[model samples]
Target: MRRRLLDIIHRFYLDAISRLPPAEFRRTTGLARGLHVGGHCFGPLHPVHNIVVNSIWYAAAFPVRRPAGSDDEDEANALLSTDGIARICHRSLDGLVAALRDLCPSLSNGDALWRLFSTSADLTAAVALANGVSKSINYLSKVLVPSSPHEPSVSPLMLSAQVLDCIASQKQQFKGIGNQVVNVVNMALQQYTQRSGEQLKLHSVCGASLLMEEGLENCYHINFLAYHEGSGSAVGAPVLFFTEAIILSCYETDIRLCVPVDPVTDIGCCFACESNRKMVVHPCYDEYLGGLEFQEDEVDYGSDFPSPLDVDYIFFDADRDSAFANYLWRDSTDH
Candidate 1:
């Protein structure tokens, strides 16, 4: 349930920014080279929020079935279901706020809480709007309740007519602080969702770009290298790319490295046999996915490396598991 809530909230934010004008879109999400947090910007953004937003964006952006039509609307158009809206404001608005208040107790003395809000002003505003909505809903629920026997009979159509008449006739006037607060709360559902969605996409793209860049530079061949960042327990594994789709990946105790010359057998072998002893093979298709693990022994750079007939030097890492070292291996004749 928590997972589903996060997913819905994520998609809500992503679709929001995708509909923005191209210029605003780029300014918010543009990439840069540096130590960054979410998207191209660096700040005190929480890592959990960053990871959650990025993961959601990754799934939405690279869906199993890429929707047909304009790129922007492919996945962002739908609003959350009625159930989701109910969840957001569940219980009486006052009840929900009271529950939240009980959990936090105080926000002013909390240095961490202040820091979180200070880092993201928009988030702070969204939170404030949420509070205002709770109060308004609580008040409305009480005042709008049916009165007793002495009250004039109010027909369903008469109530509907009154509502439509007010909406059609009265120009909404934002008067003083009270009306301003009300306006913000009313807009929170639309505004907050949009803002969050864009943030998620930006962060996700930033992370993916980093991994993809590494894979592209190291992975052999440019024909079609598909970069896949590991998640969960497999996170420690080397970043890897495959020229083809992966069908089955498993740990193999004994496997033969087919000779490069044999197209049929070579195709059967996994792309990079890192130290993990895991094997990923494509029985029916060409694409495969695997890790880029390296052995412990230091690669002797002093000695010359044998050049392959036509293949280019992909990557070389010495002291693979523990330390980081770069080694250059090139043969003039091999190229």
Candidate 2:
């Protein structure tokens, strides 16, 4: 699988860069910077002890990641990314800041993120080319997904605890609410500095998880749990494969988000590691889940997961002004 994955990535690059008009190639070349094509592509791994407070935060859209003809999806019907658009936006922020400050800073701050994303049309095109080639190769080849051919592999885990912690702490980015305070202060700082580095406050500068949690209880923390909802002693999926894990946060005043960890990655991590990386697609990316938006009431997180006892929202912190807390999370099988 690793060989096949590399092959696909190589093909994608060749196909996309092959057609580039020179200037565009120079710009994209940087994305692959220090990205070892031969060696391990996964970044350094960090182990977290307590699952109660974790950093992984992501929601996935499998169809988009796999696309109609994509192969990874055939192995499993899910699209995933360890990092969310917000994280990607942060990494790509240098370009976005340029688009804003240099290309069209005068544009309403409200449109900043969108405009920046649109301006980088070339980058998206490049990603499409790479993704397309990956899909083609997946269909053409029978690659070993397990880290080793002899080992029955498990999928790679996406999103880390630190990343999720970062999102939870960033209040400004939570709502796409720009910091008026910083804009005013930065203007004054420009007076005497010879060379100033433009800093980005993740929350104050960007909107993340794209999905809206309008009427639901909006909270700041999230958690992932692994347990079968009394479905009998069973396997989560017959076979699972993925490149990235996704985190999505929406609705809640104060609560800890809980998620079910695939056993292989959690207590079951001893399972084999998948070699191929995947293109994760989280669609309706910006929409709220279950049509439940943040409301002026009690907050909840536990509700995201179901229990035979009863489904109730989890609240870590809350003001008693509002009463009554209840929610229904839409699951994949609901449809």
Candidate 3:
């Protein structure tokens, strides 16, 4: 699921970049840096973490203590370098930040992370590692345990103790909400940021889950957590895939309890209307899921997934004074 999500985001980001004129690429990169520095948080992995936290993770997992005169040193050194990952990182972030700015101007903060559009070595290293992890996982999937036509290999395990601890702590932190609106939004945001990084305070963020049932039956519901007056912010499809990837990383093990039915669906959030809070299957949504392909009879997955253009921003409002705490996605697109 993580690999699938990465592929979805990667394709979406690259496609979006490919669509842009070469001259606009610099502006897009600037906008992306602005969003990152301004705290425009995605699910869990924010742009800051792409440098800060990832640096720590990399250092801990692979120390720089290579044996003298050993080729292993070069390999380790290369892994720590950001030379190759720079392109992918810029492409991915530029697409997301630029699209959000175009779709909803309110989210921008005008503060670029860099003076101009350029990749930092730290960022390159972080993104390089992320891409490497995705590719490694994909390769392992093909070589792992095989299964019959009726069943597939067990999925990957999500048994990170750190992740479970975060979930428990967040549940406790949000248990004080009393109002329905605040409560709903609180829960949804919690779900969206489950395995990623610390939750950001934003009203435009929301979450949705796609659950597959027996046979080909599937369920899709939007979780309207963040709320504000006016309308909800638009979320590009790449954001959706990224959020899903974060959620999929939280579970303990591969869900193999059922056949012909997916063990789980992705839970992700973006800006949405108060009216969309209710759970129902819309025609556009069904078409969206059709592209995901859950079974043999299911439609073959396509290159296109949900894009920001496909969403309709509607009014979002909740009790601001309620005991439950919530963040709002502001109207500016600067950051």
lDDT of 2 by residue, 1-335 (tens): 22332343333333433332443213212212111111111111111110001111111111124347654412221222223322332333434334334433355544544432332322232222334442224422322342455865554434334433433444434234323323322332232122334221112211112222343322111111122222344334322211111223322122112122233343211001101011112122232132323342333323333332111222312233122111111221243
All predictions: root-mean-square deviation over Cα? Answer: 30.9, 25.9, 25.4
The sequence of per-residue lDDT tens digits that candidate 1 reaches over residues 1-335 is 32433343344434433532433223212210000112211112222343334434544454344357635532322333344334422221223234334433553333323432333322223234445442234433434674576976543322234333333333232123223322222233224335444111101100011012225332221111112223422223222222221112222111111111222443443324322122333232443333333343522324443432111211211223111111111111233
Winner of 1 and 2 under TM-score: 1
lDDT of 3 by residue, 233-334 (tens): 424211221121112222221221111111135321211211233222222222232133334333332444342211211111122211111111121222
Alpha-carbon TM-score of each model against the true structure: 0.16, 0.14, 0.17
Better of 1 and 3 by TM-score: 3
The C-alpha local distance difference test score for the whole of candidate 2 amounts to 0.26
Rank ordering of all candidates by lDDT, starting from the highest: 3, 1, 2
Question: Which residues of candidate 3, in runs, are more than 4 Å off?
Answer: 1-44, 66-226, 231-335
Window of ten residues with lowest summed lDDT in model 3: 254-263
Best by the TM-score measure: 3
